[model samples]
Target: MPPFSQSTPISNGFSPNHHHQSTNIITIDVGGQLFQTTKQTLTLAGSNTLFSNLFNSSHHNSIPFLDRDPELFSILLSLLRTGNLPSRSKSFDLQDIIFEAKFYGVSHLLVQSQSNPSQFEPLNLEKSMLLPLSGRNPPSKITTTPNGSLFVSHGSKITSFDWSLQRKSTALTSFTGVDSLLALSSNVVAAGATDFSGLQILDLDLGVVRETLNWDNVTKSSSTVQGIGSSHEFLFSSFESGRRNSNSIVVYDLESFKIVTEVARNEIFGADLGSAIPSTKLNWVPSLSLLMASGSHSGASGVSGNVKFLDLRSGNVVWEIEETTDCFADITVSDTLSAVFKIGVNSGEVSYIDLKNFGSYKSWNYLGDARKANNVKKEGLGCKIECHGNQVFVGKQGELGLWSEVLMGGSKIGKDRIFRKNVLGRAKDLGGNRITNMGFGGNKMFVTRKDQQCVEVWQSSARRF
Candidate 1:
C-alpha cells in the first residue's frame, strides 16, 4: 500500500476526507506540513506542553508551529489517533521520528522508537569473551599508565594493574569519593575528588599521595570536580561561572602543581553563553596541544550544549560547535579523529560527532544518523560514550553497544559490527549493567561499572585489527 498515494485513508491530514465544521476542528502547520485534528485529541498530555499552551489562543484553522518538521508531526498525529506509527516510510530512520515525537510530547511513540538495533551488518565474531578485572575494586573511572598498566579510581581509593590484570597496589584507600582520574606519567596519576579535596597527584610505585592542588579564588562544590584532561605538561580541570570574568576551565603546570592559567567560560566570543553552563567534560588533543571542552550551549542560537576547541599555543578558542537535543558528554579523541557523543540522558537516543580534518570543528559529522537513533533511549538510566581510534563504545548501566569504525566522513555510514546489551554478561546470561568509565591504551579497553563490584577489561582479538 502507498502511504502517500491518492488511495490512502489520510487525505489532507484527515482520515476520512470529510470536511469538519469550522468550530470543531483545528489545523496546524509544522515546517509547512499540514495537520488537522479536533482540540479534544491534543488534550491528552494535560496543560503543560506546547499544544496545550496554544490551545486557547489558536485560530480556528491554520495554526503555525514554525521551525518544526512536518513529516515527523504527521507521524506523531497518526500515533495519536492510531496508537502506533504509520506504515508509510518504512525506510524512515527513527532519529527524526523520536525527535518529532518528543517535540510533540507523543510519549507512546517515543517509547516504540527506542528499541535495541535488531538488524546489523555481518561481523567476525569472537568465540571467547575478553573478561578481565574479575577481583578488582569497584571503580568510578579507569585510565592506563604510559607503560600499559591500568589505574582504576573509586574516589578515595585507587588500584593499579598490569596488562595481565594482576592487581599491584591500592592508594588513598581512605577517601570517600573521587570524581575523575587521569594518568600523568609512568608512575604518577592525577585524581579529582567529588568532595572539596580538589585535585591530587599520586605516586603509583609507592601507592601514596604526592601532591594536592586546589584552584585559586574559586569556591568548591559537590560537583566542582566534574572532569579533567591532561597533556604532557599541563593539567586542565573545571572551575565555575559563565562570563569570562571567572574561570570555567583552569590550566595547571603538572610538574610544579601550580596554577598556569584560567579559561573564561567560552566568553572569548563575547558573553551570550546559554543555560546550565558549566565545563562538565574535557578532551585534550595531544599532537595539536588543543583542548576541546563541552558545556552549556549559547542561548542566542537556542542551542543546548557547546563543544568548544581551544588552541593552547595561541591561548585562544579557534572554533566551537553549538548543539541541542543530545547530551553533551564524555568527549574523547584519537589521532586526528575526535568523537563527541550526544545521548538522550532521559531518552536512549544516542549519536556521535566524528570530528576530523585536523582539530577543526567545521570538518565534522554525526557518525550515524543521530536524529534517527533518537528512538534509542536510555531514559534516566544515564549513559557514557567512549571512542578510541575508529571504534565507538556506548555504555549504559550494565548494557554496552560497540560500533567499530562506523564513521566514514561526509555523512556516510561505514560498514561495522553490531553487538547488543548481552555482550557484557552479568546477572543472567549476557546483559548490561551500569558502566561509569572507560579508558583505552595498549590496544586494550577497560570498562568500569558503578553497579558491579569489579571493573572489566577487554582486549582486541589478534585477528580483528
Candidate 2:
C-alpha cells in the first residue's frame, strides 16, 4: 500500500495516516525511500483492524501488498509507540531490526543500539559482550605496551589482557587505593592514587613494583596525582594541590628512583603568574621536550581559569591562556603531539592545543562546547580527556564526545566538533559526581566513573593507518 493510504491504530486516538502523525514512525514511500513518522496516527479498531487481521491471518508468505515481513513490521510498530525496546528480548533478531531502524532514521533505535550493541546478536557477533549496565557509568582506561600486550585499569588494580589471544592474563599487584594508570612503555606503567604519595611505576610484564616516587609529604585528603606521562628515562606526575598555592609537578628519573625535580606553578610560570589562582591539573607532552601544560583555578575564589605551558629546559613560561572561569578537570596529548583540555564551566568546553604551531605565547582556542548543544547546563565536575591519533574523546557527566582535527598547511588548524556523538556506559549519581579518568588502547576507549564501581569500554570507529 502507498504510505499516504496506510494507517496504524493506537490506544489513545486514531491517526489519519502514519506519515501525518505527531509521533514518529517508520514509513516507506512508493519509490522504496524510507522516512520517519514526524506527525499523525491511524486507528484501525473500527474497520481497518478487521482488514488488517484478515490480511495478516490469511497470508504467511504471499502478502502481495504488505511492504515488510511480519516480524519486522511488529518491531517497527513497537518502536514507534515506545521510544525504545527491551535490551534483551529474543522474540526477533535485534541486530537486523537495529540496522533497519538506523537506515530508516529512527532516532531512539540508534541511541539504543549505541548503548547496547550486544542487543542485536547476529549483527554484533564479532563485537565484545561487555557493556555498562546503564548510561551513567564510565568505561575503563586501556593501554597497550611496546610488547603488544594490553593493560586495562579497573578500580584500583591493573589487569593484563593479551590482544592476540583476546583473554585476561594476570592482574598486577597494585598500590593502596590507586585510582589511575598509564603505560609509559612496554615494560613500565604509572599508577596514581588519591593519597599524596605521588606516582608509582609498575612493571606489567614482570608484575612487580619497579619504583615509587612521593610528590610531597603533605598528603592532602582526596588529592589526586594525575597526568603521568613519560619519556625514555623520565616520568612526570602532576597533582591538584588541596591547599592554596601549593600544587606542584614532580619529575622522576626512572633510572635513579629519585625525584629529579619538583616545580611549583609560581616558579615555573612566574611568582605572580597565577598567584590569585591555584593549580587544578597538569599534563606533559612527550614529543615536546620539557614541555608541560598546567590548568589553574581562577584567582582566589572566582570562576575564571587559566592554562599555561612551561618549558622545563628553560624553566620559563612559553604560553599562557586565561579562560572564562571553569573547573579545568583534565588534559591529554595524542600520539601525533596534539593536546586537548577539558574545561568545566557552568557547562563544559574542550580546547585543542596544537604544540607544533604554538608561538612563544599564544592563546589556544575552544574546540567546542558539548553542554551548549544539548541545551543542558550542568556542571562537569568529574570529566577526563584522552586522544588517539587525530581524534580526541572526552567523558563528561557520563556522556562521551568525539572531535577530529581539520588540518591545514600540514598543521592542525581546528577541530570538527561533534558533541554526545557517542556514549560508553552509564554513570551512578554520587554526590562526588566524579567522571574519574579515561585512556585508549587498540581501538577501544575506556572511561572511569568514580561513583560507579565498574569501568566501561567503547569500541572506536577509527580505522588505523
Candidate 3:
C-alpha cells in the first residue's frame, strides 16, 4: 500500500503547511520530562542557562526549533499530569509524538495515538519501532473482534479491550492450557495446544466452556494442531502426528462433538510408492461448507509439494494445483471477492490462484517473485506478500527497505505501482524471532513477532481499493 498523502493538516494548530502558532509557551516539568504548557510557570529542566543560550543562538533561525513540536510538548505534559493525552488538540502528529511518549514511558499518550489518524505521519520509522515497547506484556496473537474491540491472547489468557474507550474488559481464562485460540465467529471460539488432548470450544457470549474434545486415546501420541478453520456447523483441526509417522486433517462436527471424517495423505491423494509426497497445510473457505484446500507434498517422502483442493462432503480430492513445493506461509481469502493468495516464505514469490479458475486447464501461474533475474548474484532474500482486498502488500528487508503492493491487473498494462511505505523490518536482537502471524480487521493491521510477548498494531485510514 502507498503511504497516505500528507495533504491532511496536522490535527494540532501548528502545521508544516502553515507558520508557527502565536502562543508564547514556557516550560513545565511533568512526569520527569520538561514540557512547555503555558507562558507562566516555567519549570524548565536543567535550568534557564540552556534555554537562554538556545534562545539567543537561534534568534536568527526562521522558526524556533524546540526539542519537539509545541503542541506535542503540551499534550505530553497533560498526559503526565492526568494520565491522558489532551483531546483538545486541533492537530496531532502521531508518529513523532508516539516515539517520544514510548521512550519517556507515557502510557496515556500511547493509547490516545491508536484512535487519532490525524496525529499520524504517513510512514514514520520512529513510531513503528516504539509500538512493541508500549504494551505491558507481549501478546501471542492479537485479533480485533467484529465490534472493533481488540482481543489479545497471551499464554492461556485472553483479554479484550475497547481501544476507543481505553478500558479492558473481563478476562476469559477458560483456555488455561491451550496454546492458541482463534475467533471462529462473533460468538464462537476455538483453542488447541501441543499435548494432543484435542481441542476446546467456548461460547464467547456466555463466557463459558461449551466443549472439550480429547484425542489422546485416539491418536495415542502427542500432536500439535497446526491450523484450524470453521464452516457454519463444523470446525476442522489439522494435526501433525507426534510419532512423525502420520499427518492428517481431522474434521469434527462442533454440534455433535464427534470426528466426522479423518483425512490422511494416502486416502485423499492416493499416494503411490514411487511418487513424491507433499507437506500439508490446511485451509478452508468460510463461505463454502465442503471446500478445503491442503498444500502438501505430492510424493511419499514429501519431495514434491502441491496444493490440493478437496471436497469434505465426500472426503475426496476434487482437484489439485501441482508443481510447487515448500509452500507454507500466510494465506488470506478476500472478504469482498472470490480470491485466495498463498505467500511463499522461501520462494519469495506470490502465486495468485483464482478459485473460479481452479478446475480449468490454465489454473496456476507465477504472479511475480521479489527476486529479480539480474539480482541472482546477491545473497540476500526478497519480500513477503500479504493479500488484503484487491492489493497484495509486499514487505522487503533492509536499511533502505520498503513495503509495496501490486494491484491484480495493474502489472499487465505496465501500470504496476509500488508503495514507498516502510514496515518494521527485521530486528537485530530478536533472536529466532520471525513474523509469526498477521491479521487485518476494521482499518487496522496486527502483526505478531515470534517469541515476543507483545503484538504490534498499526492504525491506518487507507482501505484496500
State which candidate has the highest TM-score: 1
Which numbered prediction scores highest in lDDT against the true structure?
1
* Candidate lDDT values, in order: 0.57, 0.50, 0.48
Residue 387 in candidate 3 has what lDDT? 50
Model 2 poorest 10 in a row by lDDT: 118-127
Residue 334 shift from truth in candidate 2, angstroms:
4.6
Q: Model 1 off-target regions past 4 Å?
A: 1-137, 218-223, 241-247, 265-276, 296-303, 336-341, 344-347, 354-381, 406-429, 461-465
TM-score of each: 0.57, 0.53, 0.53
lDDT of 2 at 16: 63
Query: Order the candidates by lDDT, highest first — what do you get?
Result: 1, 2, 3
lDDT, residue 418, model 1: 29
- Candidate 2, residue 264: the lDDT equals 50
RMSD of each: 25.2, 17.4, 14.3
